[model samples]
Target: MNPLDPAGIFISFEGGDGVGKSTQSRLLGEWLREVTGRVVVWTREPGGTDLGRVLRQEVLHGDDMDPRTEALLYAADRAHHVATVVRPALERGDVVITDRYLDSSVAYQAGGRSLAADEVERLSLWAVEDLLPHLTILLDLDPTVGAARLTDAPDRLERAGDEFHLRTRQAFLDRSAQDPARWLVLDASGTQEDIHDAIRAAVVTRLGDALGVADGASLGEREVG
Candidate 1:
């Protein structure tokens, strides 16, 4: 196992597309910055480093790629991200918050596209070198509700079909069910404020005193009213 710096904490947020991961991640990143003493680095899989960003565009939006090829591309991006961004940050004792991680591949490729889950898991482990986040927060929302949250035209995977997203959503929830220790399911049907509060609570509970954010402080507690 690679050494984790005493101050390092890795937390990942996950969900199907349009589940407000981006928004919630940003909110939590800011909260961590203000409340925690450790250096906080915010990034995402498939696009954290420069190389990963280019691959992200090609992988997520490229409609011509084969399913197996797509899975490999995602793994490739994660390799770069884990090495170039995630590992180094953890070594530096920084708190790293990623918008998504390996679970996304299991949910999107294997569960959504009906590919073999074991293959995806094997590839992901090879890519990430078994580096698991200290905590993974899964935002749970219905496929239709999630799809409705998208304002712009959907991308290739986003447009895969309602059934595809339904499977993807269930995949994330199932993942949480299987690993209740490291994963938590956050209901996403509430208002943004409510959802954010729930996320902060989950983080505080999971991270405990390590986050330095106090057990009872709402995310709103950091905001200027």
Candidate 2:
């Protein structure tokens, strides 16, 4: 457990838009709750809390802002989320699975917006007090292919040009490569069930007896909060 959050397991799913991160994150959260019987907090950045919803709307749907303004807005949402929702859940020893985390800011602001990567990362670390996820799943897929999967009206990021998304995809790959032990990179082109199975296997291996899964001992009932 890190100093900011003394307990609980933190997991995150990340990828380019339409890589099925939401589907996979929810599936893994449900499976974790079913097998481990622990509280699973399924959430996402820029929309995790009430305040986050406002920020999300502004960042994605409202008027366009400069890159710095965009980065700061994301950081603001993240800081509040960690302080209110995430840190409290961790302190209660619940499992927290997020759809995206600091990595998204880095990918979007730094990679897509061409801002300084270090600056972007440092801003996020400061916001969350360096509370990195225990595990981060990067669903790797071609940006074009992933974009093809989106059905809703494209948001600001989704509407970003091809080159922007290509850079964002590369940024995610680079981050995963830098931390292979903490990251599970999988081919997102596969079926959702296949991705879930792979995530479960890795999680089982990573969590083990620490989470009482070494012998299938149920932890508690699943609670999504």
Candidate 3:
């Protein structure tokens, strides 16, 4: 079964650092399990598979590297992750929710590091075999505010400075704008509850049939809101 088939729903969360993507991903996974009783495969990029764990550590903590090297490493991890984890789960008709996906590569590498966006996009699409999410929830936040929200020591990507993050944020928005039907852009500055509500609404709208929920039924009534 192809992961992109209608039998499964693929959702990815994207945003700048400190944009609460992790929280939202977790919340949605729990909601789907409780309300819809469907298997939810919660995962992340560069760390979703065993190989991805080592690549993630190196990419995040290793010494500085060339932009092309960094992009290739990320692409490698993505390829492994999709093949070993994401694709199999989706092929089983599960809901695959990833914290980050190919868009992160496009925004961080191409937009932030001044690489050719189209080139980076092509590389990633080739790596993933053009597997895109059914819905991408983009948490839009100002880079300044996002930076301030980071309480821990900055990682290599995080320490790349404000200009890089601003460009990355714009790239996410631009991609979302280009494919409005496939993206749900929300303000990350909003309350967490509010953001999760919006995300849930979007997911329910798109995956109601797969989730086994009637189109007009109240998902909130089935689970803790």
Candidate 4:
């Protein structure tokens, strides 16, 4: 897959809610900034930009809509996000790690909501002008287990029935299997630090040459420049 930026990395975290995408995104952002000496932008789909925030609230907490409508709304959010937030940051040679991206839309809208999978994917690609993450980390976990971890009121996707979530989970796995090079699948059942370690190791490989490009040298005990 062609990277969005050769020097500026793009990464996305995906999983069912409470699978630790937020926690791990935070960790990865901090690590990339500290280790690679690059400005790391931590953002999320359907909520990364100001417009996305409104779309996110309406999609997740507002009234229900048909699958196609839902899918289009997410695509609109992503289009604006990539145009305003993600692309600009990457153009500046920054590492952009998003909590969720196109995959969530495909999985939830297509798999969970029973729309055509390829159509859902196509819609998103069209929205973002085919911007794909350089690397996407999928925190694999049982949907029920992930649900149990959530303490607050569930959102629209989380409130979706178990069968819907199961289908969504399978969609994520299927997508990851189809593109192993673009994805790193880790069991989310592990401890947070353990999962983070695995994610960091995978990212380090991609950043093998990027470290030199971003920092002018390999990372060392030296302070981040």
Candidate 5:
């Protein structure tokens, strides 16, 4: 793929359970297409491709698996996702937006499960091979609030409880704080319109040139220094 196109930005949406990631991702994807006229490919982690979706079901629904084993499953799904979906889309100069990525694993499994963060990061680096998203938007919300939005009984991970979600939330915050330039925290408590507005603003401010024209200032050209 040529490196000159400015349409190769990958933006990821992240947060704890029921933090409105799905809703915001849809809204943002639609808005980007309407405003920027760039083809947008939207997908979710652990389930972007066929193999990834199967692995996602295993990891999310199957019986108890060790943290390391579960983490490996997630990494596998991510690898396939990046290879089949994300990489191809970006090579075609499409804006690929994913619902979650390595950060979710680091927060949920490593941070919440008490596994080593360094280990998770190391494994993720191997899985993604340095294809980090140009921007990660983390929707910050209270664990209780986010969990309550789920109508059905909790899944294995969701049943991990409020404390687990709290830890995951903190993990996300810590990561965003650590990498201020790459991550943006949007409050997920208010109206959907408000949340969408904030997200749009962040995208425009962070990826101004990439939104419309093909300039060197686009995300494809500028590496996160």
Candidate 6:
């Protein structure tokens, strides 16, 4: 049975570093609030809750560890995040827009680190009690281009090298292809406005009935930064 709350909509934005996921997630959350008049919970993985915050710092800055250890720490953070923040928000009938979800674990831990993809996926699903996003918008971009867009110092994962990022990107594409209905693969090279428009359209299409809006109804134009 589906674990997600029937009254809530869950959307996740996923992409490599500097691919504009944070910007897009914020814009989408704002648009959803305006259109649906429902509470929108905008959050991110590995730092969405109190426990997650500490785990995020350690995982991103601490000494290098075994790939399995890193994956387990991420799963632990995800378990706490979903149980405390995401699941409760969904139970309250809110729209939850997360910056990353289980797919990120599969991509980064499994693909980037060369671990078993199925194992990584299984660990994440178990951590979240089988919860899954209603929609996953993947901003696909060339790793080189994405790296160039990052203005900050490299984090542990960001400095994992081009080959790792390439594998991660391919993993995302492969997963999207395997589940096309729940995934919207968008090119990250597009203008911000254009990308936001496409994302908005996808969200509207999926949740229009729940939001009491007709298909293709315009949600009004607004600048998204």
Best by TM-score: 6
Candidate 3 residue 125 Cα shift, in angstroms, is 0.8
lDDT (C-alpha) at residue 99 in model 1: 94
Candidate 4 weakest lDDT stretch, 10 residues: 215-224
Q: Give me the overall lDDT of model 6.
A: 0.90
Q: Which candidate leads the pack in lDDT?
A: 6
lDDT of each: 0.85, 0.88, 0.89, 0.87, 0.85, 0.90
Query: Residue 92 in candidate 4 has what lDDT?
Result: 92
Query: Looking at model 3, which ten-residue stretch has the lowest summed lDDT?
Result: 216-225
> What is the alpha-carbon lDDT for the whole of candidate 4?
0.87
Instruction: Estimate candidate 1's alpha-carbon lDDT, on a 0 to 1 scale.
Output: 0.85
Candidate 1 residue-wise lDDT, 15-78, digit = tens: 9877889898888888877766567899998889899989988986766777899999999999
Per-residue CA lDDT of candidate 3, range 1-225, in tens?
Answer: 223967778999999999999999999998888777779999999799889999999999999999999999999999999888888888888899999999999999998997999999999998989999988999999999988888989989999988899899999999999999888999999999988888887777887766776555454545323
Q: What is residue 158's positional error in candidate 1, in angstroms?
A: 0.6
Stretches of model 2 off by over 4 angstroms after superposition: 1-6, 215-225
If both were scored by TM-score, which would come out higher, candidate 2 or candidate 6? Answer: 6
Write the residue-wise lDDT of candidate 6 on 1-120 in tens digits. 568888888999999998999999999888878867789999999899988989999899878989999999999999999999899999999999999999999999998996999999
Clashes of 4: 0
Flag regions of model 1 displaced more than 4 Å.
1-6, 219-225
RMSD to the hidden true structure, all candidates: 3.0, 3.5, 2.7, 2.8, 5.2, 3.2
Global CA lDDT computed for model 5:
0.85
- Pairs that clash in candidate 3: none
- Give per-residue lDDT, candidate 5, residue 83: 83
- Cα lDDT of model 4 by residue, 1-225, tens digit: 454767678899999988999999998888777766778999998899889999999999999988888999999999999999999988898999999999999989988887999999989999988889889999999999999999999998889889999999999999999999889999999999888878877776765466543323222422334
